[model samples]
Target: MADPSSQNPTLTTPPPPSSSLSPTPQSGTSELSPPPCSALSFLKTANRPKLRVTSEFDSDSLLFLNKVSCKLFDNLAKLKLSFQNNSQREVSQPQVSFTSKHVSVLYDIEEKNTFIKSNLDVHPRLQLRAIHNVKAQQGEVAMEANLTEPGYSLELSSPVPIGYPRATLKFPLGEISLQEKEDEEEEKQKRVLSVNGILKRQAMNGICTALYTDEELRLRYAYKDDALSFIPSISLPSNAASFAFKRRFSPSDKLSYWYNFDSNMWSAVYKRTYGKDYKFKAGYDSDVRLGWASLWVGDEAGKVKTTPMKMKVQFMLQVPQDDIKSSVLMFRVKKRWDI
Candidate 1:
């Protein structure tokens, strides 16, 4: 045998076991110290549970993700198919797709009518209703549209509060006075002649006696040979005789009628027997009187008749005074409307 220890490879010294050590505590009556600890126990005390991070999903999570992805793919495929079908149909057949959809909300509910609300609150407000009236079909809806309608009346009787101050109108009072002037005395009282004129019987073809009685006529001094010929000046007094005219007429007579007079008519005479007033009437005879002659003519009657009868009318200052002025009073004559 050649070197049996070398051939068998026997160790000169045995190796120590792989065991860990730590500081131990002292156990004594004076100062206590703990026993030494093992490295494996220290490792057990220091090591914590490790967390595993992964990107791969679990079965439940994968199922949810698959469901969502499948739904999205199906929707996209349907949309693409629809678009392709629409494109093909559009080329083959003409179709009118009305994108302008009329909203039914813009209608009058109570009135059961539709209207266009151009400025509606939330909507675009461009709304329109049917032009003609029609019974609403099944599932028809009415909208609140027209706030007002024909024959709709509202009366506001109560007073409302206005944000304004109260207003007032105040007037100041003033005084006024008049002074009278003295007139110079006349040197002599002039002599005057009193003339009395009477108006007599008058007739007409087709006229009412009440029309004549109710009618008013005025006389003015048209012209005179001398300005102060008749009793200085015919000063119309303020008495009833100055402004009023009267006539005694029969039941079959009318006083108001026109007359054509010849010139140079004369009075009966100067009399102090002052009648109430001078009365004029249409004459009965066809004879024509003129100027001052007709003014004092007595017992006259209506003569020639005409279709549209006109009253020979004249006006004078009824109350003639130096200070009182005269003005023309107009009466509207009724005319036939047919012509």
Candidate 2:
């Protein structure tokens, strides 16, 4: 406490500023530094399509499902239609059969013969004139020779009745042998048909050319609004032939075709599979088709017999797989038999 003014003369000096301070790192460099990788990232690469994984699902099971889907896709194919005969014969020939051979050919032949016999007595000139007039009105001419009074010329060939003379005679076993022969002949006739029956030639609506079973009858497909439709041909004789048809799809085979069908009652259909069960379905549609019946008689002077025959056409479809079901659309006649 000596003099306060004298103590003020002894004040200390201040310390110097620091020169060793370091510069801060750049913000861009810090942000770009690689981050620590996760355990899952080591297995994931950039090549394949991304796979979703679950705890309970094994990768192998996923791979199996994928493969199955691919196989199924490869097997899917187009649908088609064809025909089969009574001899268990599958013919690729396009034909539509209405009744089976046993029922159709015989019955039709009988019908034709009966019709001819009933009308044979009528004057041919009258019939021809009527037909000719009709054609003339339609602005057309009859291409064949004028049908005139071709008198009762009758001859039965081929399917002729057997043992006519002998069977009629009275003998010990004559009746029994005749009966046996008759049965044999009947069976033979039922089994035999014209391998290449006369083709009924006709021009349909100009779309598809139909090859008729009994004759050359051509039906056409009518195309409208990206849909294919059927147009039946005009038959010369209404009772000439019968038609039949079927449709099927082979997703695995890639096939689709239709033969002779006077009607559109059959169709090829498909559906989505239910599951691993591989279930399927099918269906058919009814579309009318036109056909005809024919009878031919030869000139009377030469003694020619008219062989009247009826042809049956059948249509069917098949698939390779066994697990498919079929659903039908509708069976209808787009056209009718034209006489």
Candidate 3:
């Protein structure tokens, strides 16, 4: 009699809403979500292709060209086009080259020349290299062995076209240590002595080398230190002697002088570098009675290894003391790119 609906409390209570635990149909998602079209368009842009080109220019009378090169196939190959003056040449020369870790091949379209080089790592301390010229139908094979424990190296090279073989041996003599006394600075310098011996086959008499002799043997001694280097060389039978010296004033400044007793000629050069981007050189030759000054705008050798692209510019002036009118001013610009 106490009301049946009041006795059943569960039945009297209203049912809980279904949308409490899950999102409702009209409400949107609460978590972060990326736009559908943005991801697809981003991938398309990232996979797009690109092209790269390199070029060079020169203002000289060396019968050269203004060359441009295009990289392809992930930079494993290059196609080059060389342009020259119409008065000098008719058509541009095209060149192609392919390179890999152990081999390289190059071909010239106009000259119909091909060059191939292969390097083999036979052992940890031994290496072999072979070079072939298609046009000349000639080849050369070279081997190098390094004995690090004794500080000795051996190199042998032989020509396939001709029976000319050569061998060179290099070894360290000893080292002398010296200390400098200064008020505020103390430095230790090492004087390293090394020797080089070269032996050539008798058939190589007609070939030109540093020293020519009937015994086909040459010896050179090198002494190097932190700030000074001296190299004295002599040949057997001919006994032709040459001396070279280099003095370094600082890390960026140096002077080099060399004299050849066999030719009775001497040459000297002074070089100064301004940071890593600029270099200046002045040189004089007694044999030619010529003096030259050169300015380099970039570190050609240093940058090539670390950069994918680089530009180099060089300005040179040559003065012949005997004939001032024969003086020449030359400049060259080179740029390279990798794609």
Candidate 4:
């Protein structure tokens, strides 16, 4: 017998190739990474702040205050809440936004600072804002306008349909000046009155002052894709104008240039980063009137374990200014803890 069963063999087929359209699932935390952008993009973002609590400890302030023996409110605790509706497709109900923050000196438990704000969409094109800044008092009803002071402020804005411009009207009620010295002193604690109306469009934005000034204009452009940008703006009734350019050559290298046309002055800056935790910037400004150079270094680190905490510190130096002819040294630090 020549093993007839073994001679007759079975044929097995291989599996089909995996499609490139779908990502393969992995066992661990293997999520897709985020998209890439320029090194300076983060500085330009008008990011809507999120809800969080921050506990800060400023070592420089601590040292300076200790040196001067005027330590009052250095260490701080801050709580901020911000919420908004980011949906675009659904437009049935009114869109809304809320933001509030409370800040207090850790050492002084009684004194506190608070800011409450709200934005509501009256319609698809109309929006309203209300903001207040007054600490809560026991058994006292907080009114829309602070009874002791006019701390209430409002803003109304109407944005045109997509592809159009936006307009805003600001009513700084808290900014009103008083006639009497007592009234002025009372209103001094509140926000100063500087009402304005603004019209904004892509690449161009303008502002018209209500209580003062004629107008302000801004123009922006990108000189290179993901690499360079230039912004120029001028203010009227003051004859002030500025033009600036920014460049991000790589993840670790950046540069910027700024010019004050009215002053006939210009400045240039360069920045570099190392790994993920360190960054340094150096720059110089020179003109027919004045010139100086400066440098800054900052670092941040975090640990996400029990009693979560974060710390940030920065050191800065500037050369020659304001009668005295010597380099000035400055230091700042901040630390945060979860509540």
Candidate 5:
């Protein structure tokens, strides 16, 4: 990186003879000549800031976690096996994921809710991630496993939570000022503060901060009443100088809106509940332009449910093209049992 302030060789010119100097009209001092920068300005103007696209996912789609919980293995003492698919794909292209949790309601070894949740990803690449939830009455300490994906380079992490108090004052247009500076080296990242027990886990807590670099994580801060919250965070990679806005009218209300934005992109989403087991979401983004609005109507609807098991069957009409003859008929059935 050569300094732009340095003089350029192509712009240099020989000085005129002293005898050719003309007296200044306003002062005794000789009139200063034009700066060398004017001639070599093209060399500096050639450099331009590069444009960057941050996120790869820029579409509007429905995302749901398909999970089945079974207690058939309760003979193993509160041991449960759960298989979940965490991918956003067509029903024909579902992914594979598994989880196992050992929980005790009355065991006082750690707490009444002493539980260990572990997840394993078997396909695409074998990976494992686990969290230890050591909860008490007021505060809980969570320890995360330091594991890496199967095919990636060796990832060794020793996660130590360095918790602290963070205060934020919000301004309009998603601009914020922080007192506790973002971590400089990003060596030992801390965990973000959460109000899961306090606030019903509706917010993604760290919002009113800046992401200094790629190593520094851009955390989502949870918002409280009057658009105020005190949350801490661990460093994650993000664009610099981004802002988030959170607003909730009431504490007991489940409806909330969150908008996060930086220079490159922005996104906003709001979720509301109709009744107990039904909820819908409406959102828009700068990306995900409107595609052809497709619709599906059919007569395949049957579900059977009891206290211990559930079964559902549906037939969907998939039309990738505008022509009706090109549509494909699909049938799906799901069944699960509990003991």
Candidate 6:
């Protein structure tokens, strides 16, 4: 006979343990723990909106505060307070403005003026603007259209109730390529031509304007390259002409010149930028017989509105050749805060 254990294997082996009674490590134990309080608080603060304040101060020739302005704004609206000091009187003005995705409204307390602007969804390039003076009971409305495909624009404006309307049209003619010969040392250049037409009805009788006749017309030519730019414009009827050019010697140095043939005046300016925050400009004007110099700190490339810096300062000086004793010095300071 076999042994009793071999004959009855079920009795010798112990029964398997149930899964509910077995001991095992928990797989989600780490994930069940809560995050730190500091991390949650940081995330909440970052998503909240904050108010912004901007202050600007300007001093003119008399070394007095010519203008002082303070602005407070948030995501929806803006409020501005300004104080102006002149020779005759002092004035304090308050302004408020509200802005949305497609519409904006502005009001001036001192002047009793209201301005409204809206973008029309019916046309991608159409815009409407209106202004009203409550004290004078006068208003104006303007409509503008931008044709991007043809590089053309049309604007029409008229006074409220009864007034002559003014219209302007601007279109680009074409562009020319000026290529250099293989042996030529000069670089290739491109020139663009554009034209502008203005039609206006006379204020006296409102009958002077004709569809075929433009009250004023102008032709503009522009040539720009990596290091140089030249722009010239000539006006019809009056035959007035003006020219402007800029030359860049380096990434941070440039020289600019402008001349008006009708006025027989000219100006030349040399600008040098150091790093990202400092700029210096020196210039002379033939019309005013003045030589001027200016220095800027904080804002680079003259981008005052978009700079992240908190403070910006500008200092300017003008010396007259005819009367050195009547020289003028001016300065401006701007500061911004987020709270």
Number of clashes in every candidate structure? 29, 48, 0, 4, 10, 0
For lDDT, candidate 2 versus 5, the one ahead is: 5
RMSD of each: 50.9, 36.6, 20.2, 22.2, 30.4, 20.7
Give lDDT per model, in order. 0.23, 0.25, 0.69, 0.42, 0.35, 0.65
Q: Write one digit per residue (lDDT tens) for candidate 6, span 1-339.
A: 001111222245655765876655478665335556957876664443344556667776332232222222234433333344444555455555655656667677777787765555557788777766555677788787887767777777787866656666655532211212233334663332223333333233222221222246565566677898887778777889998999999999999999999999999999999888889999999998999999999764464555547778889999999999998889988776665
Candidate 3 vs candidate 6, TM-score winner:
6
The reply for model 6, stretches above 4 Å from the true place, is: 1-49, 61-91, 122-135, 140-158, 164-214, 300-309
lDDT for 253 in candidate 1 is 29
Per-residue lDDT of model 5, residues 159-236, tens digit only? 224434332322232322222334545787544332111112243543344334333444444445564534433344
| Candidate 3, residue 291: how far the Cα is off, in Å | 0.8
Model 2 Cα lDDT, one tens digit per residue, 21-88: 74455766663355457334633522222222111112222211110001111223111112222223
- 155, model 6: CA deviation in Å? 7.0
Could you tell me which residue pairs clash in candidate 4?
A: 55-336, 57-335, 175-192, 175-193
Q: What is the lDDT of candidate 1?
A: 0.23
Which candidate, 4 or 5, would have the higher lDDT against the true structure?
Answer: 4
- For model 3, residues 47-79, the per-residue Cα lDDT tens digits are 422334445566775444445454444555554
Best candidate according to TM-score: 6
Which residue pairs in model 3 clash with each other?
none
Residue 206, model 2, lDDT: 30
What is the TM-score of each predicted model, taking all chains together?
0.11, 0.16, 0.59, 0.41, 0.28, 0.60
| lDDT tens per residue, model 4, 126-240 | 4445444445321111112222323333332222221112222223321322211122467365534333343333333332222332224333333444776766666655667
Q: Which segments of candidate 2 are over 4 A away from where they belong?
A: 1-35, 38-41, 46-67, 70-206, 209-219, 225-230, 233-339
